[model samples]
Target: MGSNAPLNVSAMVVNSLESSGIDHVFLVPGKLIYPLLDAIDNSPLIRGIVGAHETGSAFMADGYARASRKFGVCAGISGPGTMNFVPGMAAAHADRIPMLYIAGGISSHAEGKGAFQDATPGGIFESGVVRSLVTDIVELKNKENTQAEMRRAIEGLNWMRRAQSFISIPVDVQKQDVLPGQEVARQPYAHGEFNACEVPANRAALDALCDQYLFQSKRVAFLVGSRGNDAETAKLLLEVAEGFHIPVATTLSGKGAFPEQHALALGVYGFSSHSRAARVINSDELDVLVVFGSDLNQRDSMNWSRRLTGGKELFIFDDSFDSPAMGHISRQGIFSGISASFRLLAQKAADNPPGLPQALQRRKGWIAEINETPLYDHRFEQLGDRVSSGDEALYPGDVVKHLCRILPKDSNVVVDSGAHRIFMAHYWLSSGKGNYFSSSSLAPMGWAIAAGIGVKLAAPERPCVVVTGDGCMMMHGMEIQTAARYRVKVIYVVLNNAAHGAIHIDAIRSGSISEQFTKLPCHSWSAFASSIGVAARVVERIDELDGVLSEACQYDGPFLIEVITGVFPAPNRYYAEAEACP
Candidate 1:
């Protein structure tokens, strides 16, 4: 009854995590997990943070890894519980965060024998997790190998560090026993090694390509990706852009990587990207397009493939790169380690002086032209006017921009998935490296609320904000209570559009506004916020936005503000419609 039973598999798993420096595990209890839960209850080295749902647990772990640069663990029951985490796991995998997923599994002998909740736990998580393995490490027959299996799990967890990995332990094995190890030493996995992209080979060949573009082209551009929280890389890319007098555009993920307000900063160039950035990409101003760490996914790529015509295009990326099955847009592809590529570019710039002054001047002119370009109609701005006056009623975009202005130079911003991401990318500015985070690949809802809590927990001193749409707010609204219980001081700003604004707008554009069942009736978001034991306010007008945000920032604990916003077609959708007409 004391669970002093010889080394339970669950105890070994917890010991392994403890050795690997994982101090916290997020979990939701279920009957299948009783054995493992029993082990967790007994472990002194690890603590379990009970989450409201499986997805919340997974998101919490994902955020912990993203912020702390270490592995976070999540545990759940098999079948339905594990299935609930698929979206969060997908986001973790796509975004490359280190997280371990532990799920309680049915006995191997009883599996598929019509046992209750007899799903193939590993198979269900195969696509979502980097790897899925089931172990019977506590088998009495293999008492000596219990520690070995634990070590293997830690190694496997390391592989999932940037991707979600699953360790499934059969209930019977977890309840059974094996001889405990003589001593519990910390298990070591891969040490500090750069998992970033490897630099491309054929440097001489690339130098020839760069020389040709430098001598022949009138305009060139550096399309930077998220530099993995490396501001030095950002500065180096900016220097290269300045050396060639070419504009630098960024992906949404690339927003904070380059200070967008800079004169040479072209703007975000994706589906919801700025008009000026789109114009530059659309125009003949591009002679050589250099891309870095770009996923080139639908949202980031503006739903259109880059057509390589008279000009040449180059891509430098890490693991997030997605090569289209149709074809590639690049004349030459470079997978250089990010730092190595930067070094090479620096040397290349130093060696070749291709009218640097003239190029720099030409780039300045291009920047000026971009600054003068008009933007999309401000429908949200008009909506803010319909509510209240002053800062309390600022549009979600304005609210985020203002936060950027006041946020400490070192604070990080993590956004959940929704239409609100468009606003954050377009307006928010980061002062230094590692300033922003979001899930663009899977774009799952309910991520930001839990993720913000995890981020705050990981870096309590650093203020974090979760800017999410009402739809997203609805998905994870309850998690605010979790934040309150944990004393997380993250600010939550909900862009309330009265409906599923993004989806509604998409439906309206396609001539089917009536089918927007995704939209919700106007709800008392502030009242709901108050129920979570956090301060809450609702801004119906534009002018009230600033004061509320200021107070929220100063609040001692978690806070929420629901700002009414109007939905409009995103930039890429506008273009797609125009193309459809012709």
Candidate 2:
């Protein structure tokens, strides 16, 4: 819209970002981004700040994007900067969050010419990031041409609901001319048709199938996924379970989709999930597992070949139609997301099916049985309840659990990876699917704290919680400052076990039990968060968790709760090996 002298590619880049509505750039500055730094200093459009690390920078951007549902930008120097951002990029991709990555280059002209610190940015991030590009700032015709290139990059980013990277304005490019450019489309954001699986034309046919196998099955159950976490869908899922007289189980990601406190709601399924949920999956009582968008991976699947053998256990229905049903690939058609399918089920079952009362009763009975299971106890297992009061006490799980219990019940949640993951997955609990997310597959530390920032950004009205562990906090803990700087009130829960809990268990199991090596002394993380302009507290005892969490729920802005819990005992390899062997 406007023109500036000085004529540098960095100025053009910064101008384009500000014009396009990017507010802050999360970064760890390098010589390559000197122009951008200069541009940011000169212009009021974008705020450029340093992060503890590039991953943290990317995570901060991700957090901003998630909380705002707009684009978040992460910038750094080419090689190392790009490398550090890779893990966060992968997390964004896997979770389907949009992010814009800006990296400084040696000189587009010297990319492969061995010009000083030049490295092929594209190949450098091939495996981790979903998309990337490299360009020469100096080669551009002028400011106009530079703006056009920037627009194209933005367009490419919008095309994918994931991460995209652009290596811009090498040192040479920074010295290039700036020319005016044309505008890209000035249209409002569009919500395109969500990719979904198709349903059959004849409702009668689906109803017939349901009656033949589902209604007749003695031990039918439901496994709801994130796609069907809405109120209408939840009610429908509950009704269907009642109609068929089957109990309903969920994944950690699927939690809060089915009210865990309900009689029919069996807790999360997986190695780290509640024993009650695990028992249902492992038992012979489960003859027909009606799955809805629940991708039965390691976090929810325990182990692919073991636990709930899919052959007879699964009755899958999804929109993609790729046969997400365990051991039951469709002969024809794909599965859509659970929304459409759940609606159909609800419509068809308005009559409550044939034997609804008996099914509901049976589900209730099973729930009662589960409630009696002593093995599922987590009452004093975590630290929040034990460490309330004294201003510096919180267990990550306790904060998460309190948030789950007291926050707007319909809120969305995002978690990262850590020993805290197990506690959150197994104990914090949610009412349905899609309400909770974490690095279940990757289990990378530092993921949730940043992800929490993203979740709050993505769904601002809904209360968002990010569950992190001590190890995870260190990785992206610095971003809490970013959240504070941006005025994003994302609730953070850090499990402070004083060590890499999972690795500690793994090391010991491998016969290396050096406490000195595995156990790191506790650090004052809450004070650190406070230093960064956020209200943070630490919890040591189990009883203190809930009350402090209740108090934290009242405040707004970025908040941190550090809970102390021991590394949970590792699952015996006997089961993992059994599946691996045959």
Candidate 3:
């Protein structure tokens, strides 16, 4: 009974997180997890951030993971608290984010005894997480067994890259003792310590495919996705496009994958897409299409339009050969990393030059045609010009465009789901990798505020700006207090449109006259932010936008700028086209 124990099970768990390079832990405090909280508070290598809600905690972890390119950790209590994590975990799962979810369970003896908050752990998150483990109290009591289980959980996380892993510790087990010098073991995979893996490309096979399809084709295009949207991949893509006279288009999630300002870049494709990109992707003249990293989902592919890929010879480069996102159009699918595949292809092109003067001239013609033609509707163009003067209420697109010009090139922009997201997606220019973050697959509202806080915590030096709608902000506005508490310098740009803008737009598109239900009562978001000790401002005119944004950017702490924008239509011609078709 008097034996010397080096640490407790809770301490061992914390040690494992530290070894995995996780520096921040987002959690909601609970009595069941007091021991774990105490351990985290005592650890020098990790810091604990309390969230306003369990859902926010999970989203915060997701933000940290996406921004830092490291695994994020979030913990909560049993039952309701665990259930709150379902939506956020599902968002991470759908978007392929790595998150470590920890939860407290009822005492081992309370099993089948109708104990308080006695729901089964990990049951709610089974669909969202890759693996879930419920630790046995008896196993935790033994030092060797504890180490083995910890290693097993971490190994599962490492193997299942970009997926969530769940582990639940019973209240009784968390207090168990660990023997001296019983540290968790590290198992490094060939793909380094994290999810960034490089698969060797088959140079010969790639060259043959490129010569047959790319070099000989009359029209070729590249569709890039979030997976291969990094700077290294982007640079290689530009070279391939320029060398072979191809145009590049990206998914909404991959908006910043290629520089939008480049002449060869066609901007985003699918759902609320740029007119030029959609026209090129749907053109019958495009004989060859090379897709990289994107899943080619309905949102990104416009319900998998036959016009977009039916006649073209599709070449897909993804991490897995059996990706469900590839659809049925790919004639050739390569199971290789996007960067590695492109690198080999780029090298082969250099070795065997294909001098296609006609193709180059055609590509130049296409660019000039797009530049001369109006991309957006005439009504939207007029609104954009009027909003620039700040004489009337601000438009979401104008706000995003101004922010793009004002913020530093390296600023990390996190956008929440709403009609505003479409505006931001179309207008925000991303110059670097990981500079823009949004959850398009799941499209969860209120994600940006919490996720922005996590992004700031991960990259303290970089400016993290959150663009959210009024309705979206109200859902998780309390998280602003969490940011203030941690001194997270995130500028909250609240587009205060007094309605569920997306729902209103949907109703209008459906020819419904009764959209009053979507309207919301206006609130003073600036006053709310100031009450929470954050620097706040209300921007009523376009003239005030620049000065307010500049001041918020310069502020050393949390800041909120509420811009009163009336409900307006997004530049979404795809919705209209889909409605009219069939």
Candidate 4:
């Protein structure tokens, strides 16, 4: 609970946010938001994080929620400031991150008039925010009405499924006084407080299905996704897989849900996937596929080809049964939370004990087959001899491999969109949940640095690394100053190829030899970082990379490592196929 003494509307809003358990508010301050900013500065429960851009603040909020599994809050002024949140809010919507967006509005009396920074008819933000409210402070003269409106706005924070709430407070009304009044009626269900809406599993029905699929099926596979990637749910998923002798695979968004080093772990399955997982998924021996918390999107399903789930029977356990992914698949869908559903299934397996001596033997055979398969041939490892022969410069793949080997197992890696993302997706081996973070659905550029800052804030003790491209760094490079200002330690690895490598490859595949606007002038990233008071280094050769990274990792503040790599096409089989077509 916040202070109950006499306060203004701005203080009331801040109190409500703090009461809802928001620990930080990312914002870009403006003249209209002075009162709110002052209230936030004075509040002990919430800290204000000032970002270089509104989009960066929104992305930071998104990252905070993704990493901590708690509600995130961000604020901006009206008009252009509010418009700046569109891209980041859209990304959050696509990925199902919870956020609260606060915007300072023009005075109510000036509505429809040409006032400065006026964005009237507030519907401009409706598409981005799931729920919104525009209330004038003067309309609520007493504390009772003001508290009711605030409570109504707070109710929208309860849903975590890509839920974003917007609140627009008029400037004139923000300074109005709010006297003590009766408490508003609390809702029976509050966001992040009650789990009454959590769907429960029917034990009898689940057991019967397991008997048919788990015991009788010749080959069973388990696929987990971001929705069920929590530590507790992951533990139970592993237990059930081990008990039933089932091999497990994960979507790219769900990478690290299952330990990549485990024998049954099949790595990521889909675009740029591990070869063994792809082979197992496309094999004819598989009879049943169990999906937990995956949306089965085109990317997750490798463009939804029949090779993955053509003849197999599907069992999908998700919180929402109306998911569009279930439309085409032949599946018996269980609408339940991942944790509750897995617990019941694990209990049923323990009681029934599907006694099959062949299960372990089959599991061992699959592991052996995957180990012997040359599914993922590391192109960088092949090019190592060439680099030593002075034929080729270092590639992004080489950098990723060295990072995986040198960085601590508990370190968190946040990757931005570009050729580098594909390299890290296929090569970076994650050992635990929350160890990897990315925006695969939105694939927004400039997301890594801001999101990495938020991750560092949420888990201050862990080392957070950001892998981005030159284009991405240029988009939000100013955020490095934000990191330095907060003294948040983050290792930023910039793969500088002096162009949008993915787009360049696309152009080359399209038969255009001359890259027109894709090429960019090389900028000294180390000098730019140093100007912002961040320690930085430039690594031009492969031999210098490991040592530079080691020294950068030991520094106590923000650090940047710009790896000067040559322009090369992204290592994706799909690109090769596209180039071969026609």
lDDT of 3 by residue, 1-582 (tens): 123556888888998998888899999999879889999998898999999999999899988987777778899886777778878877887887777777777777776666777755323332233233211111233445778777766654431245456777777788877786777866566676464545567666677666676665367788887777655677787777777667788888886677776777777888677777777788776777778888887777766676777677777777743355554454556667677787877775666555555556666776676556334445444364331123566777778889999988888889999988888877877764547788878978999889998988998888889999889878999899999998899999999988888677666567475667777788999999999898999998877899998899888899999999866777777644754672
Task: Work out the TM-score per prediction.
Answer: 0.80, 0.72, 0.89, 0.89
What's the number of clashes in each of the models? 27, 60, 1, 1
RMSD of each: 5.3, 6.5, 4.2, 4.0
User: Which candidate leads in lDDT?
Assistant: 3
Q: Is candidate 1 or candidate 3 better by lDDT?
A: 3
Model 2 lDDT at residue 274: 65
**Collision count of model 1:** 27
Colliding pairs, model 3: 390-542
Could you say which candidate leads in TM-score? 4
Worst 10 contiguous positions by lDDT, candidate 2: 132-141
Candidate 4: tens digits of C-alpha lDDT, residues 427-496: 7887755578888788899998898888888777778999998999889888888998888899999998
- How are the candidates ranked when ordered by lDDT, highest leading? 3, 4, 1, 2
Candidate order (TM-score)? 4, 3, 1, 2
Off by over 4 Å in 2: 2-50, 61-73, 94-98, 104-117, 121-218, 225-246, 305-307, 310-313, 318-334, 351-414, 505-510, 542-547, 554-557, 564-582
Better of 2 and 3 by TM-score: 3
lDDT of 1: 0.66
